[model samples]
Target: MGRRLIVGTTIDRVDDKSLTENSAAANRTSLWGGRFAGGPSEALARLSVSVQFDWRLAPYDIAGSRAHARVLAGAGLLDPEELGRILAALDDLEAACASGTFRPTVDDEDVHTALERGLLERLGSLGGKLRAGRSRNDQVATDLRLYLRDHARGVAARLVELAEALVEQAGRHVDTAAPGMTHLQHAQPVTFGHWLLAHVQPLLRDLERLRDWDHRTAVSPLGAGALAGSGLPLDPGAVSKELGFRTSFANSMDAVADRDFVAEFLFVTAMIGVHLSRLGEEVVLWTSQEFGWVELDDAFATGSSIMPQKKNADIAELARGKSGRLVGGLVAVLTMLKGLPMTYDRDMQEDKEPAFDAVDTLELLLPALAGMISTMTVRVDRLVAAAPVGFSLATEVADWLVRKGVPFRDAHEITGKLVALCAARDCALDEVSDADLATVSEHLDPSVRDVLSVRSALAARITPGSTGPGPVADQLATAADQLTTWRNWTAESVVPR
Candidate 1:
């Protein structure tokens, strides 16, 4: 028997028996069954199927199919009636898939196969015409791109929400001081607002990365047939436009083979995970009794089963742990693509799970992280109390000495000796006598004690981006404005799309 396919307004026929025989000898499915004497082995079918994870791409696949049907009609391949019927069938299939009434069957090899089966069931022989001049290779590649583009916008929106939460919390704590650390030891005094704003900056960068990734991912691959350009007169540009893609692929071989977008997205998500993990670590530490800086809301925390007094930071810990998983997702995709040759390969099927899991993990993580941060209780008094401890004012002492015309190296030595005196006497730098201060350096006069107070120490840092009240206020205002811009952008650019 022979089968005919529409190619660029012309009909191309093939000897189905020979093609099927060849494909079956290779243990392919009925979609290429004419030459096949048998289906794939059970183990191979199980191994090759991707419907389990790729089924989430069902809507994108249907969108691509609708566009392809229009192009086919424009090429004079599908009549108006057939095109309308195909589109209607796809709409019905999409509804069923969304409602959970329809799902992939055991024999459905992948999302494409499942949807093709659904279309066939809906339109009977008419559904068979829909596959003309298209290959699963091109179809899947296009669908994955569409899926990522759409979800990347969604992720951006969620990130904006988290950023808003951080900014709001920062505004609430603008005057609340805390001990800032370097190498896990107290280094300086900083407002709680400054600490929170520190996290917001990285999140803004994460949003930028997502936007860049989306820009590169907006190209379509719909007309790349297998590993070569499609034989049909179907317009890849038209399909790209219909699917909201910015451009069509320039090379069919690269179009089908390239997965750099997936890798980039994974990298962006992994970066998001890394940022969140840092924030989570802070939450974990602040909630500890030793720090006593913040308390997690009961709703966002968990109690231990065996320990009666335990209220654990499970959400933050999970956010931290899931960061590793996100990195693993990036590595998995990179490894999968590293050895593949030109064009499509079976290994590409492994790409969906890692990418999908990355999305799932971040989507699950962001809301929880936002809620945890928003609802947590801040111990402002405790923070202020700890802010000036551990000789955090030592730098202020050095700066005061430098202002008094002492060499900076001498000022540093004077401050280090004063810190040692305070340590030996179990007192603060402010408690040192004026006579004791003179022993360190004559520049450390009684008047230098003015900088020992936490408020004075913070006030002295009036430089831009410093923790001074004026600088922090400026930072907070800038953060608020930037956050408003991002939120507006997300609402206008991402949400509607």
Candidate 2:
């Protein structure tokens, strides 16, 4: 029940006779080991075990089995009695699995092996007939697609929740100006709302990617055998319809080997992690003592164990850090697929852990990041004061000169000289004297001071996608509409149970 350190180095040393006996014992119970002389030895068994991670797929696996049973009955491979008995056994096994009443043993090499073992326990020799028209290659592929399609909706729903936080916060600060940056230096004034909405844009794209990925993933691979399809009269379309797939496999070999759906899911989740990481970076910086622009609630933050004065943005930090893990998962799966020739290879077994890790990582990370965004407080006074700091409104001065018939290149040079003079005098762009402004450039008039304030600067740029207040308002409305569309999407996607 607790941690224990092992201080021994004795490994299992099996002689040839004992190895043969162990392998022979494994052959009878093992799936697809009958043709071989014996099954895996100790080294192979240790390397071959996959039931541990793959057992989470039991529910989807069971659903696939139910569909397969109906197809088997239709194909006359199983009588009505056998089909009824198989379905009942699967139901019992599924319930047992869900309740922790049954589970994979160490001897079971994979989820398919474990489930077959369970079925054999239930129906004796009749359980063996269930494997007649299917292969683990098709089963695993179908199970993974079903599992991901269900979880994708779940992940997208959480994303919409995060977007809700962003839109809600954006709505409140629609007119509250803050210093926006380029290259981490003050570049212009923008509403805090616009910054929040920027995070949502990427997430909306992620959600859209999930929907698109689902469309490509909706085909069923249940009847695809190891390489080619079966000689039996199994109706893949019937299996597909029962399992809620849009269609069945077009090519059995490709169906058996396809991990494209898993790869696309990894890419989508990795992009989500990147989007969350960017937002996390901003939260860490903005909530720091120097920025003082935002504050996190105690519920969403953490305190250090030894350092009494430390309140840590561990949630944000973890979200930021997990981006690498997500990206690594994508790269790992891609690399695994790069060298595989065709059809089911043992190398493809390496794909599940990384893809599963991506789903688990985002499943845990998204809600916490959303809560952090929702509960954080914006320091309005600090934001407004900092909005025009470092002459962020200097762009307005340049544009003001351009409006007065000054060429942009000449206007740019004049603004640069004025900025240099202000720096030399240790003052702001507007703090330099009117005479100093004229001395800086005759293009400057006292009326050029009109656009110096952050509010004036924000109001001047009223383009649809700009950071100006009216544009920000329009985009906010657009964001709200997008969230509504997302909610409707999650509701309508019909994720499999």
Best by lDDT: 2
- Deviation (Å) of 261 in candidate 1: 0.7
Model 1: ten consecutive residues of lowest lDDT:
2-11
What's the TM-score of every candidate structure?
Answer: 0.92, 0.93
lDDT of each: 0.82, 0.83
lDDT string, candidate 1, 1-497, tens digits: 11111011011111122111122222222456678796788898878766766777877788888888999999999989888888888888877877666666666677788788788878887988888888999898898887777777667778888888887888888778899999989999998988898999899999889878888988889998888887789899988877777899999999999999999999999999999999999899999999988988899999988998999998999989999999999999999999999989989998888888887788778999889888988999899989988888889989998998889999888889888888999998888898998887777789987877888887777899887778888988887787677666555331111
> How many backbone clashes can be found in candidate 2?
0
lDDT of 2 by residue, 130-195 (tens): 888899999999988887887687788889999999989998898999999999998899999888
Q: Model 1 residue 455 lDDT?
A: 85
Q: How many residue pairs clash in each candidate?
A: 8, 0
RMSD of each: 7.7, 6.8
How big is the positional error of residue 110 in model 2, measured in Å on the Cα after superposition? 0.9
Model 2 ranges with Cα > 4 A deviation: 1-28, 492-497
